[model samples]
Target: MESVRLNNGVEMPLVGLGTFKVRGYEAVYLVLDAALRHGYRSFDTASVYQNEADVGRVLKELLPKHGLSRTDVFITSKLAPRDHGAGAEAGCLRSLEALDCQYLDLYLVHWPGKQGCKSEDPGNPGWRQQSWEAMEGLYGSGRFRALGVSNYTEGHLRELLAKCRVKPAVLQVEYHPFLVQSQLLAFCRASGIHLQAYSSLGTGCLVAEPTVAGLAHSYGRTPAQVLLRWALQQGIGVIPKSTHPERIAQNAQLFDFHLAEEDMQALSGLHSDTRYCWDPRHVV
Candidate 1:
């Protein structure tokens, strides 16, 4: 798999397995096993996902069976907003315990919470600044190899940068053919921050879109592949999730093809500024 080097010189996989809305120990084990067998070493999970223990259990058991160690895989987790303030550090520690790992390869603020919730709670408090301070402390402790935020707008990032001594190493967001987020991408590149794209397949909402269908047919690939390649060409890390073994394998087979400059522009032109995740306004 290809890799992106962070400002601190840590190497992160350009493609990873995203575990969102995936539940139950049995289900997580099935997907995690498939992902690992399909050459996926980077795994993204969060406390809110409620599958950390299952994921950790599977990894601990499977790695030994495959002759792999914790150091051989890149594990990432997020700090939930409800755990902000004095509870933030403790929350991360709990996640570490659940994941059965000594340190995380990456840790992110799940969202810039208003009070502490990312959805429809405008009155949530002490989320942004408090969570950031906790993350900074985690970074200083050397427990997390890298620190970042997910679903943060430019304004959110600006606020953190102004107060954070250790600038975020990454900014994860919903990005795809329909929402390119060009300005944020440019700003992140300029600031030496790695930008990761979630919902890179347009959240499966593009399956019926004529534009994506046409492009997929032309390339003789799935729509998912087309969208993922587009994001990679833009130098953004992508974590596309799938439970089907074949689809999981297909998502990783992107390095063999290159999208032409014209095709790239065509995909970019399809952008409608669409977002498939939670609203940042409610969070921040």
Candidate 2:
């Protein structure tokens, strides 16, 4: 797998297995096992995803079984909005306990909360800055190898940079062929922050889109592969989720091929500014 080095000098696999709605120990183990077998060493999860323990258990069992070690994997987990404020460190500690790991490869502030409440308010009271400070504390303590944010807009990032002692290492957001986020991508690149794309396959919409299907046929790849390759070519990390063994295997086969510049431009033209995840404006 290809990798992008974090500002902290930790190398992260460019493509990873994402567990969003994937549930249960059995389901997680199946997908993770398949992903490992297919050469995926990076795994992305969040507290709200509700399968951390499941993923942890599978990792513990499979690593020894496969003769791999904890250092061989790059595990990323997020701090939910509710866990912001004074509880931020506690929340990260709890997540570490849940995952049965000594430290996380990357820890992210899940969202910039609005008001004091994390779920309801669209604009919160110093929530983002507070959360960033807490994250910085954790990172300084060596609890997390790197720290970042998710669903953060340019304005949010600017605020973070202005007040932060430790600049964000990454920005995880909804990105895919149909929602290229070029301006944000360029900003992150210029700022030396890695861009991690969740829902890189267009959140399953690309699988059904005629453009993707036609491109897949022409390229002799699945729609999912085409979409993921597009993101990879743009230097954005991609985490695509699937439980099926075939799909998991297919998703990891992207390194063998390269998407042409013309094809990339054509794919970029497909953007409709569609977003399947939380809206940034509504987030904080």
lDDT of each: 0.85, 0.86
- Cα error, residue 131 of model 1, in Å, equals 1.7
State the TM-score for model 2.
0.95
lDDT by residue (tens digit), candidate 2, 32-92: 8888888999999988899888888899999887779999999999997777776777888
Where does model 2 exceed 4 Å of error? Answer: 114-125
Output the number of the TM-score-best candidate. 2
TM-score of each: 0.94, 0.95
For all predictions, the C-alpha RMSD in Å is: 2.0, 1.7
Cα lDDT of model 2 overall?
Answer: 0.86
Candidate 1 ranges with C-alpha deviation above 4 Å: 114-126, 282-284
What number of backbone clashes does candidate 1 have, counting pairs of residues 3 or more apart or in separate chains? 3
Model 1, 208-245: lDDT tens per residue? 67877888898898888888999999999999899888
Model 2 scores worst on lDDT over the 10 consecutive residues at: 114-123
* Reference-based lDDT, residue 90, model 2: 80
